[model samples]
Target chain A: MWQALYDEVKNEDFMIIAVAEESRGNETAKEWLDLAKPSYVTLIDREHHVADLYNMVNVPQAVWIDEHGRIVRPAETAGSHDAWRSMNREDMSMPEESTAIAAKAQKTYMDAVRDWAINGTMSKHAFNSAQVRTHLALPTENVALANTNFRLGFYLREHGQVEEGDKFLKIAVDLRPESWNLYRQAMNLREIGPNGFAANEDFFARVDALGAGRYYPPPNIEGFPTEAGFVPVS
Target chain B: MVTVLTEAGATEVVSAQATGDDLWFAKTDVTRATGWNLKPEGLCQGDLCVPVPKANSENFVREETVNIAGFWRLLGRPALHDQAGATWMLGASASDRANALQSLEAPDFKLPDLDGKLHSLSDYRGKRVFLTTWSSW
Candidate 1:
């Protein structure tokens, strides 16, 4: 999907740089990159460096930068919606209605990207500097501290201190509970119990707990859908 | 040995001393771990200098060693470590991050591709970039 969009806008001096935020390192992300066979640049980030720099709390977030290296848009949900929450756990299949909404959401996001790629600063989708700053999730003291603990945790785990690493990882999540990226990545590192289904159930339960919150924050782009079902799960 | 994690990667501060919440390092080790050096004026990096308060100088410096973690706190940056103080991670100050965002410049970072080739965000200057992040988990 990203490759197709890149192909459409590559002629406009536009490039897509996809980063896989995998704590388990290159091997964990290698298979997906190989399967995609992307022509665009694909890098693996083991330390969540990009997430820390961009103040991203979730995955599938994107930032738009212009020719001058200025951010035209701060990190936000790229094209995914929360429709997947409604997927049947047994079959992992989404309902037809949900699938249609998800597809529309993705198309809407892609069209906006194309506009910015072709029109540059003149594009309605491209935000001004002031707007970009307003949208940026500036890190607070706690957020910065959370990042430190996360980095230490990752380092400890990589260096063979799994028990100590888990402690710091837990502290990282506790410091910034709103950061699903931190929470989910930590969960992925934990030793799964014999009941493999426990992890999936825990994830969904957390999603369900966000009764009114969205999993994917609604994009502020013009014409982007914010209908009841389209306001991603938080 | 104290392990200090920075954007440049981890550095082992062999002569570091951890006392309670404070991590003290020799003047040279401070520079080696964090790139900030102590001088007659104050703690400095390049042309930038943060003058240590005359009255509270002891909080940052004691004889030949400087309290590295205290220096970070003095600069309004996060200085974090584990209970054992064996590891430390200094984070960017909130104001620095805010200033960068206010300037609208995308933060530059470098990460390796699957083939171990490094690419920096700044390398793609003079073009439009759609930087996106995802995870398998």
Candidate 2:
């Protein structure tokens, strides 16, 4: 999807930098990159450095930077929706209506990106500096501490200290529960489930625990859907 | 041996001393682990110097060693460690991160592509960038 967009605007002095926030290292990220064969720049991030620097709490987040290296948009959910929460657990099937809404939300987001790419600062989607700053999600003290613990945990685990690594990984999650990237990555690295079903169950349960909160908070942009079109299951 | 994690990567502070929660490093190791050098004026990284508070100078500096964690706390940055203090990770101060965002300048970073080729965000200057992140997990 990003590749297609990048192709459309590559000649307009627009570049797409896709970073894989995979701590398991290059091989894991390389497989997907090879499959896509994206023409744009693709990089592997084992340290979650980009996430830490940008204060991103989830995957598929994006930031917009103008030609002069100024941020026109801070990190936000990039064309993703929480419609997956409405999927049928037994069949792993999504309702057609939910799928359509999800597709529409994604298209809306992509269109906004295309607008910004072509029109640059003149685009309505391109936020001014003040608006960009307002949208920026600066890390809190706990979030910063969580990032530290997350890095330490990953480092220790990579160095063959599983038990000690898990300790800090758990602490990282506790320090910043809002960071799904930290929580999910920890679960992934630890191989929390013996099988896919157990992992799915755990993920579903966490989503359920959100209550009224969104799994993917809709991006605050013009024409963006404000709701996931379904009330989250309590 | 104490391992200090910074943006420049991990450094083993062989001469580090751990007292309870604090990790003290030789003045030389301070510059090795972190870019900041301990000069007579205070701790400095490049031209940015943060002076040790006169009232609590002992908290940051003690003879030939400086409390690495204390220096981070003094600068309002997060300094974290394990129970044994064998490993430590220093995080940027909230104010510093926030200030960068407030300035609206995209924080530049260098990362490696699949082929091991490195690319810095600044390398794409004069071009609009759509910087996005994903995970295979």
Report the number of the highest-TM-score candidate: 2
Instruction: Report the C-alpha lDDT of model 1 over A129-176, residue by residue, as the tens digit.
Output: 788877888888888878888998988888888899999899999999
- Candidate 1 lDDT for residue A10: 67
What lDDT does candidate 2 reach at residue A178?
81
> Pick by lDDT: which candidate is best?
2
Worst 10 residues of 1 chain A by lDDT: A191-200
At residue A222, what lDDT does model 2 achieve? 75
lDDT tens digits by residue: candidate 2, A109-165: 999999899989999999887788778888887877788888888888988888999
TM-score of each: 0.93, 0.94
Q: What is the lDDT of candidate 1?
A: 0.84
Candidate 1 true-interface contact recovery: 0.86
Fraction of native contacts under 8 Å reproduced by each candidate: 0.86, 0.85
For model 2, the stretches where C-alpha displacement exceeds 4 angstroms are A192-199
